[model samples]
Target: MKYEADSPEAYIDLLPEDRQEPIRRLRKCILSNLPEGFEETMSYGMIGYVVPHSKYPAGYHCNPELPLPFLNIASQKNFIAFYHSGIYADPELKAWFVEAYRERVPTKLDMGKSCIRFKKPEHIPYELLGALCRKISVSDWIQLYEEKISR
Candidate 1:
């Protein structure tokens, strides 16, 4: 995929009806709590919240145009995915995510380096997920990637 969404609204509109609700709910949860420097856009075929690489310029994998994104939630063709970079970016957050996922999700969900997949809105723990989304301030996220590369 080209990884482009015209706007958050348009992106959700593209998804199927069943997909729309979960995406909408997730979008609401994320947008309501994002940090100041973070931006929401459609990227990678999903709703990407970019943590502009400029604010935390010292530790980007590439150019400074990139930002530290905490979560990238997208309504895929088959499922709704909640990508939380914090799990891999910060160890403490990873542990917390594990505990939260186990305690709240209660499903044998698959995981990527930082992505957590769920089939629907009911699968997500709104409050815990909201808290997770809120924790990734631009500064903390930048420090997270910096700490990653330094290792």
Candidate 2:
């Protein structure tokens, strides 16, 4: 199934009923915690939120019209996936995330390179995840992108 959201907020609205709860939880987590000036929109057939404006000054995308590092919440599939930019921030953060998950990695989850795919909302450690989000600064976020893309 094609993953599509008319607007970032509407993206959550369009999700299958079963997938809505976790997506809501994840969305709430990101919105409440991510730094201000982060713009929200739909990109790459996914719901995306970006720091600063989506176009002006530009982010890493072939087309400036569409936001890069699309953070997706898919209803067709039953899991929450964090797209680029948010993932692979720092090796230490990455290591910290992986290690943290290892302690309670759900058997039902499946993941990609930088995504933590989980079917259930309960599987996520809200405190741990939110703390991680709060911990990183904008400068640190820039460093994350540089390290991730420089390679």
Candidate 3:
């Protein structure tokens, strides 16, 4: 779904009733596990956790004026997506996430380089996702992102 919300709360309010609860639960899990210095905002039509410009003036590599993206949660036509920038830039974290997810979730793991796609938010493994979120701080992500993009 194409969303145009000015804030994360607005984004959530835009979702259908069936989607709201699941996304809320997922958002709770994500926020509870998030490390310090990450602020929630609306980005790319989704609920985004980012390193604000105040903390990282360079912002995102593709758009320097925007805040650096950390993670994004969105409801799509066919599925819900959780985009983890940390796992995308760090191979070790990706491997660990995959292995841990495989051990916990009996269903197939549908994912891209950074986005974990699920037909419904309830299908996601909250514990593992939370653990992954806890693994990366804003500073850690800035360093990792800088290293990856600098290459």
Candidate 4:
């Protein structure tokens, strides 16, 4: 579900009452562990963590007007989606996350290239997500994005 929100607070406000808290918790988890250089904003209609243009003037390769996105979280139609670009770009990181998730969460992981979907909000693994957020710094993401993702 795409919400037209101007800010992260607004995005949370727009979600269903039950979804708000989980999204807020997920947002907090990411914010608390995210590296210093990434900024929080609304991107692709979700709450996004990105390397601001102030840090990388060239901005996102696909669209120079927007900041380079590192992560995003959204309340989707049937689940909560956590999108981490790092896991999609780095094979080692993806493998680590897959293994760690199996060890930490009892349910089967529902994941895509960059999106990790949690069908039950109560089952969302906040600690593992926090650790994932800490795994890559803004500079490290920039380097990886340039090497593996950018055209």
Candidate 5:
């Protein structure tokens, strides 16, 4: 579901009461473990963690005016979605996450290239997500973005 909000707080407020807490926890997990320099904002209608234009002057390759997005979390129609650009860009990172997720969670992983969908909020693995957040730093993301995604 696409929510129209100006800020992360507003986005959370717009979610259903049942979804708010899980999204809040997910947001906290990302913020607590995410390395320095990524800024939180509303990007593509979700709560986005991004490399601000101040840090990456060229901004996002698709749209230069917007910040370069690193991660995003959203409450979707059928599930909660956690999007991490690093896993999509880095094969080694993706493999590590896939293996780690299997070790930590009993359920089958419902994942796309960058989006991991949690059908049941209770099944959302906060610890694994936090570790994933820490796996890439701002400079490292910029380098990977340029090399693999931005072209």
Candidate 6:
């Protein structure tokens, strides 16, 4: 997906009408469980929740101007995707996410290192998604990001 909006709200608005409801529901799930200090914004051509520059002045190690990305939700070419940085870093969390997803949804989980792709809104594992979102805080993510770059 191409970068379009400068803000989260704008990003939501730009989504196709059919994609809007699912994305909005997922967005609500994300926002409601998000920890303090994470800021929602448009990043990497998606709706992103990130550790703000104010919270970590060094910003993302890969690009200093960009804030550290924590999670993102995007309507892709064929699927709605959820990107979770914490799950990529923590093997334990990844395993747990996979297990929880299987327990919650009958469909096989479609996932990568950090991205979970769902074909439709009905396929979303909302509870597991919210739990994943709540698993890491802004400070925790900064620490994890720091550790990752150092290694």
lDDT of 2 by residue, 1-151 (tens): 3566587567777777766777778778777876655566666676666544433355554655543343444444655666544455556766676677667655543556657666665676666566656656555555666566634
Find the 10 residues in a row with the least total lDDT in model 3: 142-151
Q: Per-residue lDDT of 1-151 in model 1, one digit per residue for the tens? A: 2235588888877777787787788888888877778888766667888766456554336544455455688776556788888887788887887887788777776677887777655777777778888777877877776778434
**Candidate models: Cα lDDT each:** 0.73, 0.60, 0.89, 0.96, 0.97, 0.87
lDDT of 4: 0.96
The TM-score between candidate 6 and the true structure equals 0.94
lDDT of 6 at 8: 72
Clashing pairs for predicted structure model 3, backbone only = none
TM-score ranking, best first: 5, 4, 3, 6, 1, 2
Off by over 4 Å in 5: none
Worst 10 residues of 6 by lDDT: 142-151
lDDT of 6 by residue, 28-103 (tens): 9999999999988888889999888898898877788988888999999889999998988888888888888888
- Candidate 2 residue runs with Cα over 4 Å from true position: 54-56, 64-71, 76-78, 84-86, 104-109
Q: Against the true structure, what is each candidate's TM-score?
A: 0.84, 0.75, 0.95, 0.98, 0.99, 0.94
TM-score of 3: 0.95
Instruction: List pairs with backbone clashes in candidate 2.
Output: none
Question: Which is the winner by lDDT between candidate 2 and candidate 5?
Answer: 5
Q: Please list all clashing residue pairs in model 1, or write none if there are none.
A: 3-44, 3-45, 51-67, 52-67, 53-66, 53-67
- lDDT tens readout by residue for model 5, 1-151: 9999999999999999999999999999999999999999999999999999899999998999999999999999999999999999999999999999999999999999999999999999999999999999999999999999997
Q: Which parts of model 1 are misplaced by more than 4 Å?
A: 1-4, 57-60, 63-65
- Quick one: how many clashes does candidate 4 have? 0
TM-score computed on alpha carbons, candidate 1: 0.84
Residue 113, candidate 2: Cα error in Å is: 1.7
- Positional deviation of residue 122's Cα in model 5 after best superposition, in angstroms: 0.3
Better of 2 and 4 by lDDT: 4
Candidate 4 lDDT, 1-151, residue by residue in tens: 9999999999999999999999999999998999999999999999999999998898998899999999999999999999999999999999999999999999999999999999999899999999999999988998999999886
As for lDDT, the candidate ahead, 2 or 6, is 6
